[model samples]
Target: MSQVFKGCCAAFLYGVLLATSLGGLPASAGEGGLYRKAGGIEAYIGFVPAEITQGHAATQADKPMHDGVPRGHHQYHLVAAVFESDSGARISDAMVTAQVSGLALSGPRKAMDPMTIAGTTTYGAYFELPGADLYTIVLTIKRAGATKPVTLKFTYDHRNP
Candidate 1:
């Protein structure tokens, strides 16, 4: 009955609809082309060239938010859209972090910034790929009211892509 509750319901339904329509989309839709469903969550991830984020920075109204994107060689923009496995509700408020590692190389954990687009919120951040062999992208998601965090692992074979 409350406006807030109604709005959230609408958004949840929209997310469900979007998830259902995923089959029609190309696997390489976001250039990075990655999707996975595990631990009762469906994660759609895209890791592309960081240069694309420069365009986003130009459109940002806040100067501080613009510099959040890191710069480095073989850097890529990682965007992740996570949803409830059954309800299709988008989880926007979760604290998302991603760590990139391959072979003996590993980096510190970096928190993902929430980016809202068309009324939908997703998580993203910049990371180095270095054209390194196969890199494992491990995402740790912590949601409010949930006792344990959800972890998702994805493999990025930079050479093939």
Candidate 2:
């Protein structure tokens, strides 16, 4: 093959490899599964079973329900962190609210508690899952210096569990 043709082919292969590698990286806005970016801020959310948050008990029946959560329902812990979109600086002053709902039932929107964990400020709240159903979680964030609130929605299907 000619030298110029060989050079072009190598460049093409390199470009393909680069593109494929980059595609695997997280997106700027929705990089991680529970990440979203809006109104110049990035938010990360995590959900954990009540057992993990409250500690494991000898039996599932021994687990206590979080305040205000009804009995016979399983509680899920929600944790969130906000960051500046451009600088990636942790944002601790933003007001965060989580609205949890399901196709069968919708709960009231509640304010999440803000706390510092391991030097990082995070917001947390507990939601109840009555049974196997599809649930929708919507987070509304109001950050300082931002005119509008950022809203992000995530869905969870607990049909099997």
Candidate 3:
């Protein structure tokens, strides 16, 4: 206990055994929990209605739409999303874009392969609106430093569209 306090108590017990062996790892290694339940950059916009309207259900209320959308006075809104990051991490080469407005819709800003989520890299999209209400979605998600491409504006409500 004199060699410089035994080398400062062996470097404080080797930093508490390397922080308890990295806290026993496995919290998905890093950035865990599906990007804090889709409120992070991992992504989580939603939709999936094909029909219901006025009474609501044209996609955006419990994620309907695989058996009911596509009807009426023009109110499609069948968009879907669930993109999470850092699993296999490639997301079809990330350069995604979207800008949906309230509805009275058109097409294409994004529609990625029936909403992907295989293995783990998490990516999804299904945009197919023809009508609905309340929308200000604005996703970007590009790679290369990924500095300013995670903009979310969320406010979807196409009850029965």
Model 1 lDDT tens row, 1-161: 98666656654553444334432333223323367666666677777576545434222565533265577678786778887777777778899999988766886578887766556667877778776488788899888888888898887777775
lDDT of each: 0.68, 0.64, 0.42
- For every candidate structure, what is the RMSD over all alpha carbons to the true structure, in angstroms? 10.3, 16.3, 20.8
Q: Using TM-score as the measure, what is the rank order of every candidate, best first?
A: 1, 2, 3
Model 3 agreement with the true structure over 18-131: per-residue lDDT tens digits: 234322223233442212223334444444332322122223346632333345545443332334444523234566566676655433565333322222222334355444
TM-score of 1: 0.71
Model 1 segments beyond 4 Å from truth? 1-33, 57-61, 64-68
Consecutive 10-residue window with the lowest summed lDDT within model 3:
50-59
Task: Write down the TM-score of every candidate.
Answer: 0.71, 0.65, 0.24
User: For residue 114, what is the lDDT in candidate 1?
Assistant: 76
Pairs that collide in candidate 2 are none
Which one wins by lDDT: 2 or 3? 2
- Between candidates 2 and 3, which one is better according to TM-score? 2
Ranking by lDDT: 1, 2, 3
